[model samples]
Target: MTPIEILNKIVQAESNAREIYSEAESLREGFDNYVNKEIEEIRKQYYERADKMIAEAKERETARAEAAIQELDKKLEAELDAAKKHFEREKDAVVLKIFKLAVDADA
Candidate 1:
């Protein structure tokens, strides 16, 4: 081939290689974007699940505390009732003794 024709062929080959390289780079960028989007979606779902689990645990703890408080209140009420009954019986006995002493002194 003549010198000018060889140079033309080389230029054409270089152009073709440049086009192929550009196309491959574009495809790689698109794939990377798609993978990043998928990862973000998965992360959002994980955070949502974690929040729901925490709320459920808090509700269960509150219920347990309420049950314990109710049990304590019942026990305290029973003790107070017994104490009041004993105090009333003692007061009546003392009043009766004072009345008997007054009656004997008058006689």
Candidate 2:
């Protein structure tokens, strides 16, 4: 072959190699972008799930607190009723005893 033809063939081969390298670089960039997007989506989903769990936990705690308050109120009301009954049973006896004491003192 002629020197010019050989040199032209070499130049063509180098050009093809450069094109292939460029295409490979572009494909790698695209793949990297795809992976980054998937990672971001996964992170977003995880945060959303965590937030929902926290809200549910808060609701459960609030319900427990309300129930405890109601039970305590019931106990307080029962004690008050018992005190009223005791007072009613004792009030007449206490008044009669005082009256007897007054009469004895006067005599």
Candidate 3:
């Protein structure tokens, strides 16, 4: 690519990240207030990594930026999976507790 095109691409990437960041901020706010504490923390980590990548890209195409992004994605997915399992366990416990209460009441 030409020098100008490369610069343009970098600028576009930054702009795109900025736009997504605004949306991500909203999501983080909602997550903080509402639900999924685990995911909310993961999302915050993701944005931080992404911001770093954007800054790194400004210097040059680092060999590690893409790998860093992929790592972030994998980490986020794993955290979400763990959160889901935790929620499922909690739900089951709630149900079992309610059932036990009912049985005790009947007895």
Residue-level lDDT of model 2, residues 14-104, one tens digit each, is: 9999999999999999999999999999999999999999999999999999999999999999999999999899989989999999999
Q: Give the Å shift of residue 92 in candidate 2.
A: 7.5
- What tens digits encode model 1's per-residue C-alpha lDDT throughout 1-107? 99999999999999999999999999989999989999999999999999999999999999999999999999989999888888797978878888999998899
Positional deviation of residue 29's Cα in model 2 after best superposition, in angstroms: 1.1
**Which residue runs of candidate 2 sit more than 4 Å off their true CA positions?**
87-107
TM-score of 2: 0.70
- The alpha-carbon root-mean-square deviation between model 2 and the true structure, to one decimal in Å, is 4.6
List residue ranges in candidate 3 displaced over 4 A: 36-107
lDDT scores for all predictions? Answer: 0.92, 0.97, 0.91
Model 3 lDDT per residue over 19-95, tens place: 99999999999977777777788899999999999988865656577778899999999999999999887988889
Error of 1 at 107 (Å): 27
Question: Considering every candidate listed, which one attains the maximal lDDT?
Answer: 2
- Determine which window of 10 residues in candidate 1 has minimal summed lDDT: 86-95
Stretches of candidate 1 off by over 4 Å are: 91-107
Q: RMSD in angstroms, all models?
A: 5.9, 4.6, 31.8
